[model samples]
Target chain A: GGIITQTPKFLIGQEGQKLTLKCQQNFNHDTMYWYRQDSGKGLRLIYYSITENDLQKGDLSEGYDASREKKSSFSLTVTSAQKNEMAVFLCASSIPQGTGNTLYFGEGSRLIVV
Target chain B: GDSVTQTEGLVTVTEGLPVKLNCTYQTTYLTIAFFWYVQYLNEAPQVLLKSSTDNKRTEHQGFHATLHKSSSSFHLQKSSAQLSDSALYYCALSEPSGSWQLIFGSGTQLTVMP
Candidate 1:
């Protein structure tokens, strides 16, 4: 049983400030993803990486950037924080299998923009 | 484009009563899987149930869901609700034949009261 760890449980940033969230997984999974969770909007995919150094954009990728530095780590960066924006960013990893990939998520990092 | 829809944004139920959470989806892929994820307070979301077989039921932790391809629905159900069952539930779609990304629904917050 491996674990996914996300750093900085809470991040308070000012408007237009740049913030970065980091995730590390010990599952040795080949795929990693970053998702944004809003109060009523649910989880929206920002970016995903199928392998190390690979990146793919999702529906909510406009304001975010993602990096898959290695097989065990994935990171997300908020380009420019919006005023009064508050959301939780989640990081997940999965390894594809015959049945399907079951994502394992980190606790999440809450971003609060003032 | 793939998308998931969870009809209820919030549901309050008395303990020991039957509970149901509706989930529907739209997808272009023929072969796909549906997942029910539960998120406890301040905890990461975890898979509660998953099904790829059409018209077949999958269950975990006393929660069950059946994937009905004809209706594009995978609704979660439980015969008895417990106070500990209160949490946020998300319905997700995954195309195993394609990328490893999961498209999530708006999510439903279930508050089981004693």
Candidate 2:
């Protein structure tokens, strides 16, 4: 039983401000991902790390940056917060087994830009 | 260009009645995997079922889904709806042979009535 922990259950940032969200996983998984969840939009991938120091962009990575400082920790940063950009950010980790890479997700951090 | 579409944004069913959530996908790859994830309130999404083999049914927690490549669908079904099943369900796609990213659908919110 592994767990993914995301810091700051809620965040409020001003327009053009930079904000960071942190995630830590005890699963010792090889892959970590950050996703943004908006109403009626599902969850869109923002960034992912396959290993320490590795980063890959996803479908919605335009204004976000990610860093995998350690195998157990991954972080995401909002470059410049946009007003009314309210969404839930999720962190997940997975261990690839054959073709079934089952993902485990964190509770999520809700961001509200003013 | 691969995407997942969960047709029902919200589904209401009476307790003990059969329930089904439709999920269809568009993928160019031959070998792909599908997943059903359940998210309760204030909790992270968890994998309920996963299937990679075409025409094979995958079951978990009394819920089942079969990957039908011919129809490009993997719909989640349950014989009886329970109040505990009232939650948000997401359909996801994994392309292991390509970007190795998990693409998710908009999600279906299931409400079990007493």
Candidate 3:
């Protein structure tokens, strides 16, 4: 019965600007992840935190930064916004129960760069 | 590199008919696990099913998927289509014994017609 909440349902940023997205989970999960999804494309992992203060880069982490300040919160920062870089950013949390445990996700934050 | 491929970008079927979505993967592990994730409009992705045992069909909400290790495929199937089933479906892969990280496919959009 846990819920994940992402702040700012929509965001508009200019090129070279920096933006941040926040996520919170009441599940008290130990693992959290951030992903970017473009239209008609598969979601690409940006970063993940297995525990508080621990961060791991995914394939597409060069332009993004993430922080796990506590067990319930994870934040993602766009280092520099790129023009026409519109995508949805998703936050997910999972309990440590191996695979098939199901990942709980937030509604996501939609970013539009101009 | 672990990867997932969903052959169809979109699938359309009449309600009350059977439906299937194809998913394939490439991985070094002979027993790589596969997952089906469903994303409704304006919502985050949710796990529909996940399994690694070959030939054993995993079912959820009347949806089923069987992992075929030899072919590296885990195709989702349903006996009857419903309008509510329309959504974006993603196939994912993960090593059964190695990492908890998941690699996702491009995804398929399912549309059930009345």
Best by DockQ: 1
Summarize candidate 3's per-residue lDDT along A14-111 as a digit string, tens digits.
Answer: 99999999999999888899989986779898998888999999898998899998999999999899976689999998875555445778989999
lDDT (Cα, tens digit) per residue for candidate 3, span B1-114? 778889899999999999999998888766556789999998889988989678998999999998988787899999999999999999988765323778889999999999
lDDT, candidate 2, residue A51?
A: 94
Distance from true position, residue A18, model 2, in Å?
A: 0.3
**Candidate 3 segments exceeding 4 Å error:** A99-101, B96-98
Candidates' lDDT values, in order?
Answer: 0.90, 0.92, 0.87
Candidates, DockQ: 0.77, 0.75, 0.62
Q: Candidate 2 on A54-109: residue-level lDDT in tens?
A: 99988889999999999999999999999756899999998877775888999999
Task: Report the C-alpha lDDT of model 1 over A23-86, residue by residue, as the tens digit.
Answer: 9999988989988999889998899999999999988899888888789999999999996558
Best by TM-score: 2
The residue-by-residue lDDT of candidate 1 on B40-64, one tens digit each, is 9999999999889998888898999
Candidate 2 ranges with C-alpha deviation above 4 Å? B97-99
How displaced is residue A21 in candidate 3, in Å?
0.4
Worst 10 residues of 1 chain A by lDDT: A92-101
| Number of the predicted model whose lDDT against the real structure is largest | 2
